[model samples]
Target chain A: MATVKWPHFFHFSAPHSVVNTPAHRPDTRRSKSYGRSCVEPPSLFWQTPGHLTTLGHRIPTSRRAAKSHNITTKVDPEQVALLIKNEWKLSHVTPLYRFRHTQLKLYSKHLAAFIIAEKQQGVAVEVGVEAGFKVTFSAVLGIAETKEDAETVFIQVHSKPLFSADTPKAVWRGWLTCVNGDPEYLRSLPPDFVSLPLFCSSGPEYLTALVKSWFERTFDCSFGSLYLNSTMLNWLAALWTGCHPTSNIRYLKLAWNMPSQPPLDIAYTVNPQDAWELWNSIHTEDSTDDRINIEEVQLFMNGLEIHFFRHFKIYLSAGTLTKVSTALGSAHHDGKIKIGSSDYITTLLTLLTECALMKTPV
Target chain B: MDEQARAILQRVIRKIPNKKLQTALRAWDHLSSEQLESLDYAQPKWLFLENLISRCEENRLSLKDVTKLEMAYYIDNPSKGTWHAYQLFQAEGDAVSVNFTQFREQLKAHLKDVVRHVSVRTKKLEDGAVWIRIAWGDNFSKPNHLKPTYVVHYLQTSYVFVLNLMSKHKPFLYQALLLSTRHVSIKEAQLSSRSLTAMRDLLMRQYQQVFPTNQERTLKERNAPPSHPSIEKEHAECAERRHQMACEAFGDGVLPKLETAVYKLETKYRGNSNNTLNDKDELFRGVVMFSSSNLLESFRHCVSAGMAEGPVTPLLSSITQKGRNSFVITDKVPGAASQTPAHKA
Candidate 1:
């Protein structure tokens, strides 16, 4: 049996962007206040000016700004297929202390046994040997941008449900991976730790929580809930809208929270061509095809808001942008996401990684 | 009582609710204690005011003294107006040394020095909160009592809450706050609540907060998670963890009520696109507000619940992690404008 592996930090020096609009921020004194202890052995990494700076709209790194590049061939098609089908809930994991990839098989056996033991409470279930549920852990390679990035690990849970003769159906899917994490921050951690901060899961509520708890016990790490705010949804909408000319992003749909007595939810669905046109018009001066700057995204959003106001006598901007969707992907402010296409999966992953890293208590 | 009798106390007396009339009068401290004891508050509201106005006329109180009555009412019932919090940054040396009385003196002197046409009244609430009421005017006009701004601050904390402050007077008020609190600058905390108490409690984390520990939870609490064989949720430990995380991020039990969290964006749009607002120091000036009866509680529910696809993201978890509901996103990398990863959305 093959053992699970972790993501590699390939492009360790590569800088990443942060998420959210203007959310309230506390000072650095509360750094990693969520986790039990963020005590990393003092190293040369202390020289870099670090604090909550990495948590917000931080200092951008590359000499050439972040532009979307085609990473389709490098990533596994099967992995992309699994991601694009379902919406994902995101959680940020602290550095996994003493999380040995070499012992993944052992961990899998333990988790499977744990599930069985948990399912039928108070029963002395036989450990190992595939009980009622089966848990498999596998490495997903080629997704990491830098060597400092831990290679991705994918986990699946399958159940027979008394199938006896029927094939056991897959019940849960989740992965732990980080792309374009701050190299300085990753390096600063104690060598025993692997920083795969981003954890995405699709499964039953109890199962997801159980898996998370098991990881916490084994790895000495805590998971945090991260919701994508409206600013992020707008960013996603524009990013997908820009991909319209390259790949057909069937439609641009957005949801908002109205400033009403009983908070109202409003959704706007725009034709792909119209959104693309508005997007192109906003970026007429840039002439660049690959780069979709935040300013352009804002302007595109503003155009839609203006149009919406003209019709309904409501300033859509006055309402918070709660969710944004296209044929490629849809992200909710509540931290739910659907990756409809694999073309922009890398971009999506990269964005999520920054978010996860930002939540890292260290 | 005719207008003649009521005029002695100023028209603002009617603005005070009939229920709080006694407290307001007592706080005003204008009339003699013996006269106050003699007044019959249970009588018809107008008759009560008539007897009070006759006493005020005998005392020869001025219109300025009448505004004191209003300030007293506001100071006692702070929840009557909306309060916004501002953070005092770069506070140096012995910031918390000043007591409420000392702070009042410092503030009044500082405002008087900065601008002549201003009246500053300071009162310390029983709860250790220092309330400052300021009526402002330019060099030409006197301090306007009709639209005064009230500020509340606790000596130990860096946050200062204010109510009914106009934009034009923010700088003056900020300067007075800096000098009085010994802080370098004052900026909006971006968190506002319907009442002053709720905002303080939320900021101070004075409620039941959940945290993860090595010890196991009670069997009863663990079993609280809904159980069904189909979803295989028989594991109560997992559900407990979600609840713990949610409670850790946002306090459980009766949570503090915050009406709104407003984010004022001065962040550079770093999409690397042709939007005119990009680069050259142009910021995407925008505002986003999240409002609810209990914003923190609602946020906790969203984070705790499982999404159809997966679960909550880090962005959602950041509110509690950062410990602030208000933020100003700026381009930290001033020169390297093109750095984009993770932030594409």
Candidate 2:
């Protein structure tokens, strides 16, 4: 129910109306070319220093030495225009274009807000040698709830060092409440107020760097475990090529303390609860007391391990290895697990009973 | 558990001939408990007759009434029955009584001969023929050309032998006639031996037609030619181009224009403030602007109601002096020595 806090001043309804109407309607007098002639180019208005210098105050660009930080880039008018044109074209034909368009707009609005805010702060910026204004997309650390006493925090950029003068006094006073805040509750505050980068002119590589910087900030703030949503996986995949992002984050679900509930039929794969129970029965109580190494057992239960571990947190431990050798029936050895021409029906039945059990307990 | 099943079992066990009793018992033992219970024990004679008939019928052997009546007599009253006429003049030996082995062998020979004589055979269909055929219609229009229906010639005879419609099921019919002939005589069985060879030859021909001569090519490949790789590639390229065109037309063309308009409108409205607008003034202005245009009414109303905007929390601030240069009084934090790199391995 909680909606994103988009800027009220920048009304984005014009595009929505344009999309709602027929694209090639000759009867209606609405500007079919998306008001290209109505609005002046960014070059004309943005060049006026006094009017636009406020954008720098909100986003301090190129604060570090030029060689150390190559982050000062400005948004281009033509590119944005092209981006808009592409979105408009897709909206009419593609089935998913509408949804994608909405997401793009949301992201762009955030980016635009940052640009406006940074400019208002009256800070000086060194536009990079690579020409045109571009912004570094800020990582969303967490969403904060608006309590009565607590003031709403804008897109916060974390500062290094705890108990520093730059750390906001309100953060030390325990005013902010982020939804994705670390459970350990570190006291160090996010010191910088940053603008969201709307356009990624430098590609995802630069975005990856920005993300890495955010991670460093987050880690500096808290020495405890950091919990990230699964959506981060998709973001990382988009940012980096050939580098498997999931590999870096160790599976740490054991600390989550998930709620105990019956598995729903909505899941496409095997039921985790059934798999857990089956594991318990097959391995015996004593064997289960220690952590089950996923690599140690060569069971051919497709997706069983993933399903169980995903839902519930199980700690990995270096303990005595107990193998469920009977169920496997001598097919796989060591790490090499290959499915052979075994009795398919029997194997299916075994998986059904142990992993994907549909029967509810009496 | 039922009396009928028990009676049927007893009758089957007792009536089975001595030579083949062991084999019959073994086959019976393989039956599940449910199958055992389903026997018609009330009419044991009929059950024996049916079982024999089923066995012969399975081999696609057309039978005469004389054969059935004789077979029924032999099964029901095994002690009173004499050796069949076909067995009387066998070159190898004559038998006083018909045993399961001799009866089965003779029956197979006779049925094969009968089928070869009665059934009609035609040249291999070029387009191919399906196993089943009725009135031609859309539902059953074109027979699957992939499946070649090979025929075994059989002689038409006026024999009152009852049978279910099982001509389509060649394999089952073939097996039934071969294993369960009771009334057929040795003379009749011997006379049809030549016809049996012809039946065997027909079956061999059908098998050859069904299977591909070459071993490597799978049935799927044999039935239809493999799709060309170029065609698949072209199809994929076409889809990609279509998507690209769509995105270019809408996303790049129209969407950005609308966004620019929105940005322009925001700047236009905010410029009218003259640095004197309070929260109330801004709210009133927003409401008026929204009322005039349908685009921003929801946003204006939502903001006025305090449904979205919360109290402002400034994380950091710097002051810009009126007369002198702007001084950053807020950058007081000591910098860290170990800065995390922009990219880490």
Candidate 3:
């Protein structure tokens, strides 16, 4: 069965000799390292569960020469174009549309890997004080397979920074067409353009609006937890995609929805002097000698204002990350963290007092 | 010749789809009478029949499977096959029990349906071993147009193995530990209890190398540690080094909060599996804080450092040179609103 000259019947069309061609049967050579000699290279064609005929044989055809024969019978080019245009419009305008319509592409494998890893890590949802209230945003970065399929690219829709030299070139090429719609301009780009770290902002005004809404929803009632709205979550996911080389916090102030009573917004801001004193005292309180648990370090750092030194410490410490990210994602999406905890309320008030005092001392 | 064999052949041939039947018939017709005569033995005929049935099954399995084309592209690439072959050699030395034939036949049998599954498919065998099939390809086209080059089979955590029929060593092993950019935790891979420690240690080494803690750098800077550094010492050293690196990378006067932006980028670079830059180069390349004071100087530092490395320099310089123009600032809202009539509503 192994010696059957079966592959001879189906000649590979390529003029160049490929190793898989019947003419070149795999040899019985020993690898220098493996120490295992080939008994018989497994037959490319194998016996089926029930014997019938050999498969995987190729027929010779010069694809270049015969390519024209495969073309579909022509319709009017204008009509074809119009049909495609109408189809695209129908898909995009459909109320049930889930995928975004855009020409930009992203790294497919990287995007897949990122999404899988991120979902496992889970997005952190924090319903806490920043300017008013802050929730971590996520973004999707996608790779457009084709112009028609761009609608189905992994629909991460907001703009943030993507940090990596390994970012695929196709992503930038498609993005150039999406944003500029100029072929000449895309051609003008340097060969290495797509590999650069990219940052796309929804702009200061838009980000502030997102925060304002986040604050409004959280303050609507004293609650157990506040889940992030789907709209904001979607916006965050879009912005975070394809953008990396990031900071510990990418924050926007919610001055638009500042609570007028008690001027709580003013207290939210951290006084660096006070924050440092708190941090030092935590370590030195009982004795000069103090050993901190990794968990406490994380909690302490999470409570620090974005302006505080503890913010940088969180990222640099053995890749140690707090539940802050998880807390944020969960508080917004899963509604797990209870707001009734005295510790949480105190922290919130402390943050508010810091902001309020920083503005106009009580 | 045998009654039972002939009956079985007839039954199997009936299962072949019309498209595959055509292929089998065409292949049969292409064979000369002498060649046909050579396949008179029951064994050869049996092999032929089996091949036909397998082909039909493959066609059915691949139907509507979006990622098949992409997988084929990777499988067909000779260079990638050889590279994986080398990797398997290093990882599997006598430890892996499955020979090439058993692994190949099992993979070929299940690959079709597994590739088409909607969610990522991971199957743990009865023997307490786990295997996952990940489809990999560039975003050139959708899963259908381009054949995927490789369907990576990560076996436990000890090895990532593949059998490339395309390689010169057809049906040989390829190891992919150093080559693959995708980093799934060893625990996620679910290794045998015995190999777990070894694999975890190997992964830890790789992780630490990529994301050297400040303690690791400081200890290296000192040439030697006075003793085994405690966890607190390590954290403290790391924190101090981080502060110094932040000041040097950004500026002394930069806000600690603002400085974190650069630190975060460094941490990200550290965490990334694909970055090829050394620690020093990473410092320059990864510190991407957009300081108002002198963004260009920082970018210039990256380019100059990046030039020492050949591959990353172009990418580093490209972002630096084109950074300003890359982002487009567009209005989020329309200038005016048009209200449709209540009748339409």
DockQ of each: 0.02, 0.00, 0.01
- Which stretches in model 3 have alpha-carbon errors above 4 Å? A1-204, A207-347, A359-362, B1-65, B70-102, B107-158, B161-345
lDDT of 3 by residue, A1-362 (tens): 24322212113211212232234222111111011124333342222323221111111111110001111123233222211211010000101111122312323333433433433456564434111211222222221112221111212223222454342321110011121111222232222122111111122433323322322232221101123333222222211110111211122111111111111111112222332333342332334332333333333343332222211211122111111221111112221122211112222222222222122100
The runs of at least 3 residues in candidate 1 whose Cα sits more than 4 Å from the true structure, single-residue gaps closed, are A1-53, A57-72, A123-130, A161-163, A284-290, B1-345
In angstroms, how far off is A328's CA in candidate 2? 19
Q: Ten residues in a row with the worst lDDT in model 1 chain B?
A: B306-315
lDDT of 2 by residue, B211-327 (tens): 223322432243334277588666654443433322222121111000000000110111112222211221111000001111112222222233212111111000000110111
B243: Cα error in model 3, Å: 18
Error at A299, model 2, angstroms: 6.1
Q: How do the predictions measure up, each by TM-score?
A: 0.45, 0.14, 0.20
* lDDT of model 3 at position B57: 47
- Best model per lDDT: 1
- lDDT per prediction? 0.67, 0.23, 0.26
Residue A133 displacement in candidate 1 (angstroms): 1.4
* Share of the reference A-B contacts seen in candidate 2: 0.00
Docking class of 3: incorrect
lDDT tens per residue, model 2, A304-344 = 32322222111111111111111112111111111111212
**Best-matching candidate per DockQ:** 1
